[model samples]
Target: MAFKEGFVWGTATASYQIEGAVHEGGRGESVWDEFCRMKGKITDGDNGDFACDSYHRYSEDVQLMKQIGIKAYRFSISWSRILPNGTGEINMEGVNYYNNLINELIENGIEPYVTLFHWDYPMELQYKGGWLNSESPYWFENYAAICSRLFSDRVKYWVTSNESQCYIGFGYGTGWHAPGLELPINQVVRAWHHNLKGLGLAAKAIRQNAKGEVKVGLVSCGEVGIPASDSEADLQAARNVLFDRERSEDSIDFGFGDLFEPAIKGEYPKSLIPYLPKGWQEDMKDICVPLDYIGINVYIGSIVEACEDKKYRNLKLPVGIGKTSMEWSFKPETLYWVTRFISERYNLPVYITENGMANNDWVSTDGKINDTQREDYMNQYLSALSKSIDDGADVRGYFYWSLLDNFEWAYGYAKRFGLVYVDYSNYSRKLKQSALRYKRIIETNGEILI
Candidate 1:
């Protein structure tokens, strides 16, 4: 069956990943700028200094989206670009840059879904303890208010933040991302709590200062636990694993429940209540705000089965299973199971905010990039997503992980996850074979999938 009518088909990109000219726009330094400077931190010593040069060529990028027939475009705003020091005076040039981008998308009939934060925290703010500071929520709220007042007239959809688990767990717990710091579990939880508080306050600020009607949501990413079989025991086990909280002080199991529960359910999981900060109960008032929808970024999942010793265990994939260039498992069923579980638990309309695979793509002798792997990958995953919708999940939209081949964070520019291939040599754009197929899918509102 085809996806439901009015389902949104789109592509996503982040500020730091796509927008270069980081210094030319009066943009203040971000934690990522500093992280890339650390010895051996990034692959090939590659940084986003000239990533796709989207800051100067966004109009051309918009044309590419228009040609691809996408209905929406999900992109993040660089916080440092707007408030150079993360807070204080506004940077009008950054504001104008986004205003132009938004107008360009609308002029071409593409909806803009703005994500307020996507881990590009200002370096100035990082020096002030970043999310560890108790006043961090207010800081985020102020930034959100500025965004709402400036762009809400044209942009109707807003996301408070994208993937808190990564920014907290990977950034602090593992020191893998920006503002790298290998903090202990207790501190990580503290930062996570403040992040959630920021999500709530940002949501409130957006709605309060919005120029018109707006829909606010948060984008979260985590491991999905799919059942091995349709049996009741297996299903229960998968659900248990998906929602399980950290069981001990040393455990770093940052699952969907940790971030989602507080924002949507208004309380921490029972197992996590003891580890919460002293004023957490009072913080709940700001932590739990009503959201218009929930956005999930799914790339892979593991099969879960019931066990005698524990509620559930994730079974390792076979040695030769299909995998992405990033080595992530190629489990198409991840979309189905993740969308179904999230909808049933939260009872909110869901959006596949980010879903795509990375491939080692290059221009062939035919002068075109034939990324058949990504094309097949999208077919399998979208088919599973359609099945989830038919099974009564409120799956509303799907956005490919990226719109252009950009700087892939810690991996640097080595990994490519874009439907539109970009030649780094001279910053040229070419739509891959999969992009053409995606254009057809969008033109047919996914009827081509059937």
Candidate 2:
């Protein structure tokens, strides 16, 4: 079955991953910039100091998207770029850069879905205690107000933040990403509390400040367990893992509860209540503020089943399943289960915000990227998404994880998850085979997947 009419077809990109003019446009340092400088941290010791150079080449990127028949483009704004100090005076140059990119997408008939923040927290704010401080929510709301007022006239879809799980958990818990801080549980919960509150305040600020009617949402993803079999007990097991705890304690530290529980149930997971910082419950009102939809960035899935002990247990993946270059298991059916579960549980329209596989992709000697694996991956996952749509899932849209090969956080530029191959040496973009295939899918509104 083809996707319903008006289903948005787009590509997703983050500011720090794609935009490379980090020092230009009056941009200040971000936590990522500082973190990347630490020795023995990032793989290949590489940083996003000069990523795909999308900061200067977004016009060309938008042209590529238009040529690919995408109806929309989702990109992020770097908070530090807009407010170099993370608060106070605005950076007009940074504003102008986004204005240019947004205008280009609009001119090309590509709807713009803007994410207010995608982990590029301003360094000044990190020094001011980052998300652990009580004032972080207000600071974020202020930033949201600025963005809503400036870009709302042209952009109609606003995502308050993208993947709080990664920024909070990896950045603070595992010290794997930016602002690397391995804090105790209470401090981590403190940061988590501020982020959820920030999301609500940002949504409220955008609704009140944006120039046009807008849809505001938050993006979240952690460990999502899909039932190994569709039995009542197995389905219940999946639901338990989705809300209770992830596969392990380390995985649980990734904010599976902080991101999903509060947004859906207006409270932290019961298991995590013991670690709650003081006054955490009081912030539930703002954290549970109304959102037009929920965006989920799904790639991998864990399998779960009900045991004889009347408890759910996470089942290990069977050996020898297909895996991506990043070693992520290729489980397309994950889309079907995730969308259905989120829609049924949260009663909110679901958007597949980020879904793509990292491949060992390269422009071959003939200057062609014959990434058949990626092409098949897109086909299978999107087919599953179509199945979800048919099964009463209020699934709204699907956006490929990336438009261009970019700096993949701590993995640096080693992992490539893009439809367009970026020659890191010179910042050239070549559309891969999957990109052409995706163009056809978009042109036919996903009939190609059928």
Candidate 3:
């Protein structure tokens, strides 16, 4: 079989990355807003002040997705924009903005998959200890309840948060992301627990407040270990490294289980038990709420081999492997292994919520962006994904990492990862050739890849 019938083919974008009018719409300040102000924090001092101007031009964006035959659009809602302070009055303007965007998508025959949080924490909450505060779960629950009450009538697919590892580990543990703070391991663990609790609570709120049935899940990111060879030992080693609990302590290279175990299994891994806060066991009820699916944002993976001492060791890539403009190694099999591993472990349907590569694209002399490398990347990756399905991996869908070239977090706009190119100076959008290829793939329901 090729891809399963009714497989979702879509594109994704986050709020702060695309929505520009940050200061307007009665929007409150987010940690990212403050993070962008810190000197030397952002590359070339770039920020999201006017990212693609999507705030004023969302209609244009929806049309672009329609032109490319995107059936669904996965986007996030800015928390601070909805509740300026993260826990108080509702901002009608913010609600109206999302309403307009969602209505536009529905009018254009595109499904809307909403992510509640994508690392844009409210500045007011950050000052109050953010996720470290015991009340953070309720804060998120309140926000989620409002969203469900308002938009659930039209939006049915919901993701509570995107990549907790990056937000909690990199943002709090390593000081790499917004509200950057290099806290001790124990504090980081505490923040992670709070984040998980928030996810569970948010899921409950969505169910209780949704106008109708909804599919809820969490988006996680981590390494996917590929076996060095097809040997049984190597396959076991790859699986071991992907789920090992020891990797959780490394902050930057944790495994999916560090977050998924607590959220899905309702208890922290035994290795992490010591670092948990007091009364953490009582929080399991909320953390273990049932989920309809698991969302994973994958890009690259490393090779793993079985070691002599009954362990697995990840091998470093030698010189000359294909690399993206962001320097991420090109590994198409990562999509196969990640889906297979997650499906086998959790027994839940999987969706590749984000997968795409950055390319140093520019308007060529012919006035067209011929992103052939990205096109090839998509073909190879999707081929591997089809192989996984043929081997019994229950993958439900794939959403590309982005739809437009917006703010690239700390890397700024230097890296381009969009199917459609955005001229930074004029905010004009031009579809790369890969987009047309994708349109054909979507039109045929991935038959081209098969």
Candidate 4:
């Protein structure tokens, strides 16, 4: 089945990942900027100092989106760029850069979906106890207010935060991402609450101030449980793995559920209740803001089987299964099961806000990027998404993970996940075969999936 009418088709990117002018336009430093300077943090010692140079070349990027025939574009804003100190003092130059980018998208017949925070926490905030501070939620509300008041004229879709599980879990729990600090679970739990509270407050603020029917949500990336077979026991096993009471491991799904349950169900999962900080229960009132939709960033799934005592057990992945450049599992059907599970579980409209595979790509000898693997990956995953929608899941939209190849967090420029390949040598972007096929998919409202 084709996607429903008015279903959005677009591409997504993060400010710190794509916009490279870290020092330009009076922008304050971000944790990523500092994290990159620390020895042995990044894979290739690469940073976003000049990532795709999109800060100065967004017009070309927007033109690329227009040419691709997508109806919307989802991109994030750098907190430090708008508020240099992460709290006080507005940087008009930094503000102007985003304004120009937003206006460019609007002028090109494309709608803009703005994500207020995308893991680029201002360095000033990090120094001020970051999310561990009790006042962090209010600080984030202030930031959200500024963004809503400034850009709501054109951006109707507002994402309060993007993938808190990564920014909080990887940054705080395992110390893999920016501001790399392996804090204890207690501290990590504190940071997690702060993010949800901030997102809820931001949603409330955007609803109050945004012009012309704004939709607000949060973005999360986590585990997807796909049943091993089509039996009832297998389906139950998938659910048990996805939503059961196991609390031993600090998995991505745990973080995603802890952060998501409050917003959707007005409480954290039962397994995680013991870990909540004092007064965390009361804070749910602020964290349970009504969201327009839930955005999930899914890349792969884990196979699960029914176990004794009505439990589920994850089976280890066999060796030599297809993998991406990032070594992530290549299970395109993840889109189907995850979407179906989340929509039915949460009873909310779902959006695949980030979905794409990194490929080993470059400009070929004929001056063409013939990335057929990426094109195939997109096709298979999107077809899986369509299957979920066909099964009565309220899957609303799908935003390809990226529009251009840029700095990929700790891996830096080593992993390419964009439909448009960027020549780091000159910062020139060339569209791959995937981009053209994606354009056709969007133009057909995903009837191509049929």
Candidate 5:
């Protein structure tokens, strides 16, 4: 299949993951920067103090993109790095860093897709309860305003946030990430309310300031959970794969379900409020703002069975598929069904913002990285993706999960997800076998005959 006239082929990365220099150029610390210092938080006592030195190595990375023949690159801006206090003073040096990156991409004939927030919030904001504060909308709007004024001319596409459900729920509610606080069900709803509100306000700000075709949407991780067996327990578990909890008389699912339907349907998933916080109904209107395109981040899939739970009489979710480095399953079909479901239900264009796997890689003695596993993974996933588009899924773009190896959040440098490998010890980058294969696909316009 030849690439469509307007189809996009790109790679993506986040600032915190790639660009180290946490303290350079007046860059204020983020919640993750603080979180990593906590005892027993990150694996193996690792942190991202100097992950890739991409902060100072932006030009080199841009050259790598040029060599890779990537049409566009999606990368995130570090909030704390741009605005030291998370609001007031603009760090000219930090601003110059990202500005140079955008200019470099343009010089190399590559478009820059900017993601505003990518799970790395400023420590100042976290101190004030961050997304928990209703004022977060204004704070985010302020930040958006600054970013637009700075680079809107160069940044053609804008993704407001990475994944609110994961960032907010996992970071604040589940105690898995920075500013980690294990709050109860009620507080989780509050965080969601604030996050959705922040997105709407931030989108409005971006639209007002952007000079390009502004596309705004949050990234969402998707999975089509299937049951391993035909047992009634397994079947029922597959029906409701999300994490549901009954805090009050209201029963709600936290992990995934109905939460995203509102973003596309312009309404909450039918009476999903009693499970939310007080005045949560008022937020429905705010979260229903129209978006140009929605991005789905698909890594792997799941299948589960209803195991005995002390609380819910009947509850089970997709579990145990031999796991990835991130403990995710290897179900590429889930990505296909998920894309189909959203495009059919909402009739909106879908862009796969992030889709790749992390592996413990080793370079063979012949100086070749035998990523046959990744090749198989890519072939199946892209085949399903192409089929979804062929079935009229309104899919527009597909970006690999990352451009270069970088910090893996709490996992530190343990997991590598890049088609191009980065030598963290020396900041030397190499195009892995996967990168070469991807380049060939792009070269032939994705029309390779199998």
Candidate 6:
């Protein structure tokens, strides 16, 4: 595992997914807070009321990071917590909470990689049309500006948005998330433009408030479209599997109604732009502003080539391939190609910020979680990653999906992707087998053999 100097070894977590002080510390309501309140929207009618209590347990978490020999920590800041009303007023206490966190991370020798937004939209903003509103970009920039002024001093890396395609597409189309309004076809197109524009605008704002060479990364998730076999029929199917969330036909707006469009082409396939309110091209140019690097979140690759030949879009893929406890395909080879695809298409350096597997490792009688599945999965993927880097992929760093088992969003606590096993019943955390193995990997700089 020989590698160049300055490699980043870190763990990642989102604020809403972990921090449980939802209503405490002058925090305003977020869409997630509101969404979970709806009956049955979550797996077990569960809300993130006391999620790992990371808000109070961050010191312990940071200690866990140092114990694991990690050099960096990438986490998001809760929006509503900072701006309780979503605008017009700032909470000094909320700002103090984050300042304390950031300063503490730096003092403890951990680089802080902060994400401004991670799908936890302030509930107040949702009342005014959420992402669907054209003014959302202004709202986002305002939030970014405030964050920059406070923590930009210590933070060098900032990610503007986390997986725009997933949050926008799933939240609106699938009705799985907040601001639970399903809009008309044309409106959905507006939201897409607004989100991309808002992302770019946030970056611009952060740059304006920066005092140093602050770097920004945009996070997007993907699955490789694979063909069932080498036959031309199957191979062709692989080329057009556009059902991935980003490429999907689900939209409240008309333009991106096409199931999927290739990024290289530079034009969405929906062909509904005739209905736009005009100036969409300008907005897109803003959205395409230069980014220092793109953060890619890859779980597994899919066989797109398998779905094309059949009619009715009824591609019968199996329920199982390579799976974690969450049953997501854990193919790192897909990560290699997808990194190649986005880098070649956008011609930008990339970082994998979220990549890990979940396991059904039960607690042994001695109160230890021996998660060999997770350990093996990490090795398999990292090996593929090594191959990717060797093959000339411009990947700088890789942050494991998480540091510990915390609340898993809508999935509740059912799925665990942590290297450390957490006991929710008693709020106790124990390092699992994978954590021990990973510590050695980090300490040895990934030199340990598979």
What TM-score, computed on C-alpha atoms, does each candidate reach?
Answer: 0.98, 0.97, 0.97, 0.96, 0.89, 0.90
- Tens-place lDDT per residue, model 1, 1-450, is 577789999999999999999898889999999999998889999899889999999999999999999899999999999999999999999999999999999999999999999989999999999999998999999999999999999999999999998899889888889888998877888898999999999999999999999999988888888999999999988887667632667666677878888889886877777667788889999999999998999986989898888878878788899999999999999899988989999999899999999999999999989999999999999999999999989989999988999999999999999999999999999999999999988988888884
Q: Of the pair 2 and 5, which is ahead by TM-score?
A: 2
Candidate 4 or 3, higher lDDT = 3
Best by lDDT: 1
Q: Report model 2's TM-score to 2 decimal places.
A: 0.97
- Top candidate, metric TM-score: 1
**Predicted candidate 3 versus true structure: per-residue lDDT over 37-100, tens digit per residue:** 9898899999999998898999999999999999999999999999999999999999999999
Among residues 3 or more apart in sequence or in different chains, the pairs in candidate 4 whose N, CA or C atoms overlap within 3 Å are none
Instruction: Please say which candidate is ahead in TM-score: 4 or 6.
Output: 4
3 or 5, which is superior by lDDT?
3
After superposition, which runs of candidate 6 have C-alpha atoms over 4 Å from their true positions? 227-277, 306-320
Off by over 4 Å in 5: 226-259, 270-272, 303-323
Q: What are the per-residue Cα lDDT tens digits for candidate 4 across 1-450?
A: 467899989889999999999999999999999999999999889999999999988999999988899788999999999998899999999889989998989988898999999999999999988898889999999999889888898888899999888888899888899889888777787888887888888899887887667889888777777899999998987866556535654543354566677887897877766666898888888999988888999886889888786577788988889998888898988888888888888888888899998999977899888888888888889898888888988988889989998899998899999988899999998888899999989888878753
Worst 10 residues of 5 by lDDT: 243-252
RMSD of each: 1.1, 1.5, 1.4, 1.6, 3.8, 3.5
Give me the displacement of residue 266 in model 6, in angstroms. 6.7
Go through the candidates in order and give each one's C-alpha lDDT.
0.91, 0.87, 0.90, 0.86, 0.77, 0.75
lDDT of 2 by residue, 69-186 (tens): 9888889999989999999999999999999998888888999999998999999999989999999999999999999999999889999889888888888888988899998767
* lDDT value, residue 69 of candidate 6: 81
> Model 1 TM-score?
0.98
Residue 199 of model 2, lDDT score: 91
